[model samples]
Target: MNSSLTLRASAAALVLTAAMAPAVAAQPDDPAARSTIGVHARLLGEKIVPHKLSFQNTTVGGLSGVDRDPCSGEYVMISDDRSYLQPARFYTARIKVDAGGVHSVDFTGTHPFLQPDGSVYPPASAGDGKAVDPEELRVDPRTCRYWWAQEGDRPKSASEPVIQPSIQFADRSGAYRGQLRLPPQYEITMADRGIRRNKAVEAITFGAGSRVLTSAVEGPLIQDGPEPTVEHGALIRVTQQSRNGAVLGQFAYPLEKIFAESDPSSPWPPDTGVASILAFPGDPSRYLVLERTWVAGAGFKIRIYDATTRGATDVRRMDSLAGQRVVPMHKKLVADFADLGLSTVDNTEGMTWGPTLRNGERTLLLVSDDNFAEDEVTQIVALGIR
Candidate 1:
């Protein structure tokens, strides 16, 4: 796709990956089992702290894609080379961490994980690629493969472009394996935006087995408005169809109506919620959704929802994270590596849960993209999940 569309699509899709935790409800007297507004509260107001796990500066200058292996407790971060508007290289790193909040990340090697073929068995960023702005990363334990989703568009006309988010995979040992173009990638067709400029897919992750979950950042329509431009987001599940193939399911979420602005003076941007969503590990019926908001006092808001409830159950205040609150802990901008050193990159995107650390505490990590900005530095930060 063209530069404007490329920038808009990527920006809209990846903007809400980092979170500003909100205030949590007061804890009940009985610490074991307390209920708040029909939701159970446990470990509320616990003095939890976030320590840096590992930070690495890739040669590509901007990190966009991230995937964590459950079995090995290792993470793979990709530094996307979007400056030349070409296929981005994948920078793989093996992360080691302890519950005491000590983290170490080793840069394994850099490699291209896509081939020109329509199949996914070979890894090569050969010909037939526009700008490979890789966005989504998923690791499958059942099959022992790593999947990367490329965010870009292909077109039938100059005026109209068709953007189909594509995905490919690799093995745990860091082997360039196969690539798979999303099923009926054309199913997300936008007839008006030409054959190419119709849709933009961003965040992606894997579920149980061949099941994959992904999101389309916006709807087919684009409207001009204030600085905080609004767009649509969708959630879809894809299952394997062949030996190494997949098919899209009918179950897709159109988030336009999910969190619409209720008051005209609310000042909340339209189509606010719905950018990145992750399924609850043990429960297939629950999901954690990251809602994008750039308004005053609000940067990134993450909420937990019961898949059955179909509504936001709780919200986290990641910006003002103090251990005082019982429900949603808050955090502020302590340090952003990009702004601290690298000047060219800024937009923070890409988040995933790593294995548990000290005292069986799980870890949550977020990655930011420099967008190939000349003065910005790309970084990855890890936090202790409560």
Candidate 2:
């Protein structure tokens, strides 16, 4: 199941306050160089639309992941439809970005993801016996092939079977090629161990020159520790693998306390997790991680953090993070979407580096999943980064 559909709303009063509050700028002084990265975001535009944005028979709303194709200067977006609405698929789009903001977005085409058997996924009612819940999408810089992550569904009962999560490779046309093997820790089972349901792999990116593929889990594994709470944070493992799927290394990433803007004391903890990641150009050890939290009544708390694995402990050989001393990656606040001065923010889950502007500064683009809700919207937000 897609996790964004489960987000609840927060109190109206608290939502208003959070929306209007001033954003605190991030400033981390560099000890050695005596200079800060000075990262900030200027809102280009927030394009919001109805849930039924369609292309022929398919609806283009459940956008879980997005990436830019430098070769074509177009963007590719993956929908987490689970073959229920249509065969599992992705779409190519052309978005016009200018000084004013995003002027328009046009869908060029949609391609169905083919299975190894050379058949598209059947509808959910068909009982096709295939487990696919596409969560993240990326373009393999080395081959221009499309790579996607699927958070395979967990067994609902003892009688049901478990489907392990996977990262799959496909051509631009979405033909099945091969898949990357995940470590045993990511396997799902009937026992109360391993990854929690709907909380497996959620984010993936190519590091620097595309030599390494990094993936992030949505939450900590059962043995890692408990889920994050208001008072305590949790650690999730970030794994790096070679383009051909050889495991290289793994490090710990600390997740901040759950963001419940409406009611921090609310009994139910809102869904908070890593939504997207973008590797720094020519730097495999550094990345920009996007964390999004949605409270029931209030709204979204979206933040970007600059993360580095330098000097971090490699937990690949470690059995568990609990009762063990480990050094997690260093993270610094980059920008808060709330501070970007947008009128409204939806479930922003997908992000990637856009084309550089005339001034040579980089741009970031984020897309939101409406979950096919009438009250919600599918939004594409552009930001100027420096």
lDDT of 1 by residue, 1-386 (tens): 00011001121222221122112232223221211112211111111111222323334545655777666566676555542433355666676544543255566665554444423221123324444556666777576577766655655455544335666666644455766655443333444321123134455555544354543342322211111233323222212233355443322232322322235556654333233445546543334333332233323222322222122122111111222222211111212222222222234456677666556555656566655655334555555544
lDDT of 1 at 70: 66
> How large is the C-alpha RMSD of every model relative to the true structure?
13.1, 8.1
lDDT, model 1: 0.40
After superposition, which runs of candidate 1 have C-alpha atoms over 4 Å from their true positions?
A: 1-58, 82-87, 96-102, 117-131, 154-163, 171-199, 209-275, 293-346, 374-376
Task: State, as a TM-score between 0 and 1, how close model 2 is to the true structure.
Answer: 0.87
lDDT minimum window of 10 residues, candidate 1 = 1-10
Best by TM-score: 2
Score each candidate by Cα lDDT: 0.40, 0.77
